[model samples]
Target: MFFIMIIILSITYTDSYANSAHSAIVMDVKTGRILYSKNISAKKPMASTTKIMTALLALEYGDLEAFVKVDKNAVGVEGSSIYLKYDEEVKLKDLVYGLMLRSGNDSAAAIAYHISGSIEEFSNLMNKRAKEIGANNTNFKNPHGLHHKDHYTTAYDLALITRQALLNEDFNKIVRTKRWISEREGYNTFYNKNKTLNQFKGGDGVKTGYTRAAGRCLVTSATRNGMQIISVVLNDPNWFNDCYFLMEEAFREYSPEKVITRNNDIKSFRINNGKVERSYMIAKEDIVIPVKEEEKDKIYIVFECNETYEAPVRKGQKLGKAKIYIGDRLIGTTELFAKENIEKRKLIDIIKNFFSK
Candidate 1:
């Protein structure tokens, strides 16, 4: 028997997600799967939410715990500020906290200069990271998204960027932080402007932004039962409320289905050579995707592997691959591995006589 196994999973449909924002989206943080969307690809000004990228760049290229003096130009740029003075020394980590928690434009500038030597250069890096994250529609003209005609991102792109940022533990901690006290000379305490952390259950992070031209924008993330989701809204009068609705609806409608468990048996195969007569196959990683609960029966995992193995089966050895399907659509795949080490069977009966039974 050629060991082909199909594991049934579930996924279905739900009503459309509604929101008042001009462009909005909800994405599963783990899989980058969109749970909800409305005009998600429309490019719009990102405002202070731009700081999310600013913070991400710093975490990637700058030393967090190192103390560095603020650049001369970072002081008193525009919009929100941690009021960093020229040549003021602060830890790179604190600047990130200020950038995220306080939505500090000055902190954004300081970080930009500290990391890339100039705002122009830093924006270049931001664009580079956006591309790497698959946010092709996003562009950064300045570290602090004040107002540059070209500085914009689609709701989907922003959500993608936020998803990338959320992967960093440091970034995650900063955005979720409600208040931060820096060692700066004045206005030492910074309170996060993103109210989503306090306004909704399971709300953890992201950022908030507003400018007359951009209306109001918000990016929010929440975690429930080990599943995290990111939501982005651009140019909305009721940003927070819209985000909350998006979050609630997604959580209510979708489920993180663990279609495959890591290091667990997916199928057992008969062996021809050594050790045990049978060997089991498993995936090296878990495939968890968000899907509608009622449609669970529609999702299935198709395991592709050989019916039997010839020789020794090494634990963790790649045996085959599992294709995850939502209905007929192939959603994802993971490589399957041997569950345990099975040494080859030794020549028995006659050998025992030679050894003396």
Candidate 2:
């Protein structure tokens, strides 16, 4: 009786939470699988979310500890900035902090100049990286996400960029950090502007932006109970409340599930002497899913193997594949292989086996 009541309560909670988001999405950061989404693909200009890529390119290509001279081009660009002076000397690391924490427009230009020799060239690099990452709706015209006719990205694309950024050890470290102070002759402090870091429970560091043209845009990430979700809100009247409610909904609805693990052996079938035998399989890599906790037991796995394999099989040879499916959706797939070599029978043994068959 207790078990039945628990199941009922769980389902009700999932239903209510799943329907509670206004333009929200929950996805596995590694696999890019959408756990839940509402109007996530709608195209919109992403304000300072552009910094994730700017910082990414700088980290990948620019030397962090190298000294950077604030060029004339970087000195007077409008909008928010740390107020860099012309010909001022600052380390690349300090500028990155300014770029991310304060969304410094001058720092963006400095990074752009350092990376591509000019803002025009760096903008090209941004576009190239965006396409490479499968952000189809994104086009970056400026490093600072200033409004341009062509500069736009959707919630889904920002999630993709964030996922890619998280893969880089350096990029992840920078975004997750809430505060930074540069090692200069005098103390230079940069505080992370992501209000979620100070306001929300379990709120990890991320980027936030606002402008008259791009109103109250924010991309937030949080983790709880081993589940991490990234939420993006654009042009919301009440951006903080909307984002908080959306993230809370995702946390309430989705629970982390181990989709594939190195130790979780999968069973498969092999043909030997035209007879089927049970063979075990394992994942080449671990996979995880963000799903409702109650749905964990209902998850189903399918092991799709080759229709047939001739004798003389060797270990680790590619046989076919298997996948886990929940309803009609594919959760994960693993390559199927022979656990051990199965040698063909000797001619005499084959003759005897044929006669027995």
Candidate 3:
């Protein structure tokens, strides 16, 4: 592999509230870049933030319009609750809304049981989903995140989980909501506990968690100027303020820059044993990188291809790849494809060209 080195200019900022959180991280939602980190990998209880994964699985696998019969186990499971009653019929989507907006432990259990038949099985699914989303340090013991010895996730892992959850439109819609009224008769209106949704500019969907052992844990997301960021803080006394500061820092520091566009012509490669002398290649898709505005100039593109190819090359055939970098870090990559066909030269044509030469 050829190494491409990019030198990005670093920005200077004061760390005034760094000590507020025991573990924390701020990540770019689009690029999955870590903008700020403090003991981000430390294993800690995520409290109700584990509901993010629960909500994610429900949205992905359950039909929103379908009504789930509230199970007996879902009621009175502990922590905050939407006070779902046993055998009450509720829409899956409404339960999700209640789960996220209200931080309802009862809602979480109902979703867990409806989707996977039991809390233990749903916890297993949450763990599987965590690993699938690259949150390796996470383990889920229950969907409500009520506190179990094995129910723990790092700040970085929670950020990773939130990033994945934010990609779902339904998940985004639910978490950003400030208030939701259930259609059920006599049901109390659910209000979001995540204050950042209203308090912070550009703030969107995410979850908040707290327990005596977990302290205050929060995962918040916000979007500004087309760039979205996710911030996670575990066991912070000033969770809201800390997340706000981190988000502002990321938005102020970084901007998304388009590096390449699909089908845009790149450098031509020499073609051997073909009617054409060169093959033009284009990027397979757009590649965007999030970087500091001042450091945008340091973004580099390196194209790697074989010296020559024996063609008949077909249009859109993969030829090589374009690698993008920022300060020695590989940020993105896209395959380079032949823009047009290049048929191999016929034997008779080769003979005639030889004679002419």
Candidate 4:
């Protein structure tokens, strides 16, 4: 929860702030699956959520413990900032907290310079990483997500980027943190800017943004019932509430089901010319998938294998494949392996097995 947070808005849209998203999406955090979307691919200026990429680059490339000498060019950056001063030194990690919790544009600048020498260079890194994460619709012109004609991303792209960022343990800790006190200097204490962390159940991360051009843009994430959902709203007047609604809708509609368990016996199949009467097949990977309760009947597992395999079949030998389907969509597939060795049948072997039995 954001025990302390201050709201900053580009325009006061309080009176008619409902369903004002130009683009939006709700994605499953674990699977990179888009559960809901509205104009998800339409690119628009994404105010401060761009800091997600900035913070990510810092976490990946910069040493959090390293001291960053705030560049003169990095000072007094437009929009939200931790108010970095020229030549002031701060820890890379704390800057990230400021970047995420406070939406510090200056913190983003300092980290950029510290990591890539110039904001342009850092923006290149950001674009590179965005592509690596499959954010094909994203193009970053700056680190802070300030309004720029070339600086833009889609709701789908933001969800993909944030999903990858959330995978990092340190990145997870930093964004989810409610409050962080700086040990260095100047406005040392910061509160979260992501108010969804305070207002919504299980809400932890993400960021908030607004610009005269971009309107209200937000990325929010929450975990409920062991399912983590991420919502992105761009140019929304009611960003927080909309994100909450999307996450809640996802939770209500989808729940995880264990479709396959690793090394667990899946089925018994006929074994021809084998000492054993049957051969057991086991799954090699665990597959837990989120599906709607109503679709449970539609979900089915199909096994593809020969009716019988001529032994000797060794333990762990690949036997078949099991595919999971949700209606017509094939969701996942796993190879089936022999659970135990089954030697070729022989008269002497049959007599020995009979005596052992």
Q: How many backbone clashes does candidate 2 have?
A: 0
Q: Model 3: clashing residue pairs? A: 6-327, 6-328
lDDT of 2 by residue, 11-95 (tens): 1234443433335555556455665566677777777878888998998899999999888899988988888888888999998
For residues 11-49, could you state the per-residue lDDT of candidate 1 as single tens digits?
A: 233455556789888888766777777787788998998
> Worst lDDT window (10 residues) for model 2?
1-10
**What is the Å distance of residue 157 in model 4 from its true position?**
0.7
Q: Over all chains combined, what TM-score does candidate 3 have?
A: 0.82
Against the unseen true structure, what C-alpha lDDT does each candidate score?
A: 0.83, 0.73, 0.83, 0.82
Q: Once superposed on the true structure, which residue ranges of model 3 sit more than 4 Å away at CA?
A: 1-17, 261-286, 303-322, 334-357
Q: Which residue window of length 10 is worst by lDDT in model 4? A: 1-10
Which runs of model 1 end up more than 4 angstroms from their true locations?
1-16, 183-185, 267-286, 303-321, 335-357
- The lDDT, on a scale of 0 to 1, for candidate 2 is 0.73
Candidate 1's TM-score reads: 0.83
| Pairwise lDDT winner, candidates 1 and 4 | 1
Better of 2 and 3 by TM-score: 3
Q: Candidate 4, residues 133-232: lDDT per residue as tens digits?
A: 8888899988998888999999988988898888777988888888999878768898987787788998878888889999999999988766677899
**lDDT of candidate 1?**
0.83
Better of 2 and 4 by lDDT: 4
